[model samples]
Each structure stands twice: as structure tokens, then as C-alpha cells.
Target: IAGRLRGLSAREARRSAEALAHELDIGPWMDRRALPEGGGLSGGIRRLTGFAMAIAAPAPLLILDEPTNDIDASRRRLLWDALRRRGDQGAGALLVTHNVAEAERIVDELVVLDRGRVVAAGSPARLRGTQDNDLRLELQLAPGAADPSELATAPPVRQRVRTGRRTLLTVAATDAARGVAWATAQREHGLLEGFTLAPATLEDAYLALTAPGAAPGSAELDPADPHQETAHV
Candidate 1:
């Protein structure tokens, strides 16, 4: 499309399209000329295709919402690289995603909204610094290991969940070290497959800022504002 808009020959158009396919990691799938019926193309690939088409267009601004949904890790990495490159070239992109980690990685500026209101907006580092609590420790329980109840009783655990062979523990940041130490000790004793400690994230900050009972600021959210609602951009 870009080649045609720029009045390039057919050869140039093919080359341009090929280059973009490679960049978006869709080269292998390009040979499937027929569109997938009944959504046979994975949701991620469909999104990638749309993104590729949009980026290849002559638009000065691109708005993508939840661009990474259902995308595999490898392809998602490619998408991020493409977005970063576009940013480097001074393109304007407004990306909306619930994947706060991905947003943190790619966005120079972050705007967080909850219930149709902008609760926080700033750099990832700045927003992350405002998050003072809510650390999560996830334990992958080995099958037939220690009882779930025993693990749940460990220190600093505000809440716990027991699934097939996994347990999720939510804890306070002030007690994160203690919680991690306890979980690690349990792992060393052969009671778990492994454990991971997660620090407060942009998601945490967002929740904190937009949580019910949080002090109301200048009203920025409009429940009636159509644009405030979530949409594919």
C-alpha cells in the first residue's frame, strides 16, 4: 500500500510488502493466500495483519488497543521491536493494553484509566514508584507435595488460592522479603515445584489509584464519554 501510494512499480511494491512481512514475522504465513474461514487464522495473527496494514499505510498517527492479545511470545517481541522502531522514527502511537509489563517496556509515556477515568499518567518508573503495596508470590506446587493449607498459613499472605497443583498468594509489599523467604524455604524442603516473587507493577499502581474509596481528584473520567470506553483502536 505504501509503495503504491508512493507510486512505486509492482516490483517495488512486492519488495516493500515482503520487507514488512519479515519485520512482522509473518513471512511464513504469507503464502496462505486464502483467508482463513471461521477465524482459522489465530487471533494474534489477525491482529498482526491489521497492524501491518496500518503501519504500512501513510497515516501519521497509529492507535492500537490490546495489540498483543493472544500473540505468542516470539511474535509479540517482533511487534514490540516494530513499535519501538516506529517510535524512533518519530511516529505517534497510542497503545492501550492491560499487559502492564509490555506497556512499561515500550511506552515512553503511560496513561492509566479505570472505570472511564484517568487515574494516573506518567513514565513507567514514576508510576511504579507510587505503588507501595500489593506484592504477589506465586508457588507452583508439585503434585502430592505438602498440603495447600500448610502453605497458605505462611507469613504475610493476605489471601491464597489452591488450584490443581498451584497456589497464588497475595501479600503486602512491606512483608515481601519475609514472604519470599518463607516460600523459598518451603521450596528448599521439596514442598513446591518452584516459586516466583513479583514486585508491585503498573497494574498495581493503576488499581491503587483507581480503587473504590480512593480520594477523588478533578473529574477526568466521564462515564458518558464514548471515547472513554475500551475499543480496538
Candidate 2:
């Protein structure tokens, strides 16, 4: 990228490359002549190398398409810090990602797309604030215990999904106190391990917008859409 952007000489490019490699934790591979065959480089390394090139380039605007792909949590944090520093230095970035949590942390504005169409656009806070009183409750049930059938049919529950031994229950915010009380009662009966209550997040908003019976402003998305959920970018 440095070469293409400014016709940097091999020596000059090497300086920028080395700096970026060190920042992204790829300094060990900087002096290597060729990547090893077969396993060559891990997917995360390859992705981070590409990012290092772009970040080291002279381009004022960085257009990244899922820049955090295949990277570990530490590398992902490094990537965010790098991009944030670039922004602080007056560079512009356009990040394309399905990771709502990442976007919430990094971007100033968000545009949600569904089937090639823009479904929603706004700052993270604005979008999150639009949702009505909704709360998410996660409960870990005791081993070998089944979730009570009545819990799913409870009046406070708007939706309930069970994964392995854990169940995620969505309820009205107004009913959150009552919901916790009910969970506490169940815990007394040895049905629950523990539980958590929290306000709706960007993920919750995304799911609601794309749910099968989504409201007028939001469109129903196909369950098969791979981009519906993603790792933090």
C-alpha cells in the first residue's frame, strides 16, 4: 500500500512496514523472505498483515471490510486502538462489519443493511434509545434440570430461547423486577444456577429489527443470513 500510494522506495516502505508490523504484533515475521509452505501463516496473521499495509500507507481515507477477521481478542483490541489513533490524527475510516458490539464501541454513526437495502441508520445511542422498555435475562440452569414450561409461557416473557444449559429470556423492562423475583423463586427450588438482568443492547436492537415479525420500520430478514451475527471486528 505504501508503494502504491506514494511510490515509496523499498527501504522507505520497509520502515513503515516494520513500524506497523510491530504495532500489530507481527514484528517477528518482518525479516522473513518468504512465508512457509502449507500452513504458511495463520488466517489472523494474514489479515493483520493486510491491515498493517493499509494502515501504513499514506492514504487519507481507510476503507476496511471486516478488518478484524480471524484475529484474537488481543489483536482485535490492538486493531481498534490503531484505527482510533489514526482517527485522532485526522484520517477518515469506513469500517464495514456485522459486529454490532464493535461498531457500537468504535463508529460515530451506524447504517444497518438488510438484503442490500438500508434498514436503519443512526448513532449507536440514538438507535438503542428508540427501543421501548425491553430487558434481557440470562439464566444458567442446574445440570440435568429442564427449564420450566411455565417460564416460556409467562406473561412477562416476550421471547425465550434455550442454548445448551442456558436460557435467554426477553421481557418488558417494566417487568424486570418481577422477572428477577420469579428467577429467585426458581433458584430457591434448585432450578437455576444464577441469572443476570440488563437493558437492551445493540445486538438486541438488531435482532428485533430483523426478527420474523419485525415492526413497520424494520424488515424481516432471512434466518439463513450469515451476516446476521458476527465476531467483534
**Each model's TM-score, in the order given?**
0.62, 0.68
Model 1 lDDT tens row, 77-104: 9999988888888888998888887987
Give the winner by lDDT. 2
Worst 10 residues of 2 by lDDT: 224-233
Report the Cα lDDT for candidate 2: 0.71
Model 2: per-residue Cα lDDT at residue 171: 68
Cα deviation in Å at residue 217, candidate 2? Answer: 3.6
What is the overall TM-score of model 2 with all chains considered together? 0.68
Clashing pairs in 2: none
RMSD of 1: 9.3
**Each prediction's whole-model lDDT (CA):** 0.68, 0.71
**lDDT for residue 10 in candidate 1, whole number 0-100:** 77
Each candidate's clash count: 0, 0
